[model samples]
Target: MKFGTMFTDILASFFKKNSTQLYPFEKNPTPERFRGNLYYDPAKCTGCCLCVKDCPSKAIELVTIDRAAKRFVLKYHMDRCVYCGQCALNCRFKCMGMSNKDWEHAALNKEEFLVYYGKEEDVREMLENISKPPAESEHK
Candidate 1:
């Protein structure tokens, strides 16, 4: 009886369509509202930290490069992200949102997860400022 059941199951499987997808070559379509990864637009950003404050995983970090100039850098850690879409909802400037097109975020190293979003000049200035000591007047 056991041998007959096993043989019948194998015969049935041969007539059925393949359930597994040929990933990497033939990809499956993602849903319309699928929250794949966070995307940041520096031009649309108002330097507001609402996204950072609302993130449940604390994956978003806003670094103020210049208060007067309203320059900021958005540090988005993909590894720590929960993809809840709260950040996009909380952002009043409409700078942050999720992109459904590119969801492949696999990384071999932890350092690859860290994404800095900002203007070229702003990022350069921020890096330069970080390397220098605070001025005496600013320290006061």
Candidate 2:
């Protein structure tokens, strides 16, 4: 090969070898359109259990705790979830939205995979919003 051709090849090889991801050391931000996680709006959810009933994968479950308080604990099995968007679509509360927060959901214990949003303060905003009249629920 010519000297110029050899030099170009060497540079290309060097650059290719150096191209690597620094993952743990450097975190990357997700794009706005990126679908990472399914976040429940707590306020929009009426505990109708539509999502749980319609979920094909059976990954979602709504458990009633305080009947008089209109309280429900929604549990999601990350392992069984296929990210199909069906659960969000079937949701009557309009409380479910896709977020761009992608963190590893793996754990040695199977119970750890189940996520819940049951805190009183955490659901306060959502509950108040859901309790409002239809006309009052216009703007988010």
Candidate 3:
């Protein structure tokens, strides 16, 4: 009985196609509306902070660059993000969305998970300004 079962299994294997996919060589098509990674467009963003507020995981951080000028630096912590798509849905300006292209978020360092979405100059200036000591007048 065992010999007969083994022979049947061997015959079936010859007719059936391999179920495994060659992942590195052959990529599978991502489904429509696939929530993979967060994408932000600074040009479309209005500095409303709606997306930040709506995020359930508290992964979104809005750093104020120039409040009077309505400038902001949007910080997205991929490590903390739950990928719930709530931030994109809450965005009134349609600046934030999920992209299927950047699903791979593997990194050796924790800092690598932090993604900033804003003007390059603004981000640099904000970092510099934060590092500086406050004026004596402000302390007084």
- Which sequence of candidate numbers ranks them by TM-score, best first? 3, 1, 2
The C-alpha RMSD of each candidate to the native structure, in angstroms, is 3.4, 12.3, 2.8
Q: Which digits, one per residue and each the tens of the lDDT, describe model 1 over residues 1-140? A: 69999999999999999998888888888888989888888767777688888889999898887756767788889999989999998888888789888789778899999888888888887778789987779554
Q: Give the Cα error of residue 66 in candidate 2, in Å.
A: 3.1
* TM value for model 1: 0.78
Which of candidates 1 and 3 reaches a greater TM-score? 3
Whole-model lDDT values for every prediction: 0.85, 0.72, 0.85
Please provide, for model 3 over 22-111, each residue's C-alpha lDDT reduced to its tens digit, 9 standing for 90 to 100.
Answer: 976877888778988898877776777888888889999988777677577888899999999999988888888899878977789999
The candidate that achieves the highest TM-score relative to the unseen native structure: 3
Clashes of each: 0, 1, 0
Kindly provide the TM-score of model 2 when superposed on the true structure, using C-alpha atoms. 0.65
lDDT value for model 2? 0.72
- After superposition of all CA atoms, the RMSD between model 2 and the true structure is 12.3
Residues 22-139, model 2: lDDT tens digits: 8777666777766556777654567878888887899887766654565666777877887777778777668876677764565789888777766665356555756887785556
TM for every model, in the order presented, reads 0.78, 0.65, 0.80
Worst 10 residues of 1 by lDDT: 64-73
Deviating ranges (above 4 Å) for candidate 1:
1-15, 67-70, 131-140
Residue pairs clashing, model 3: none
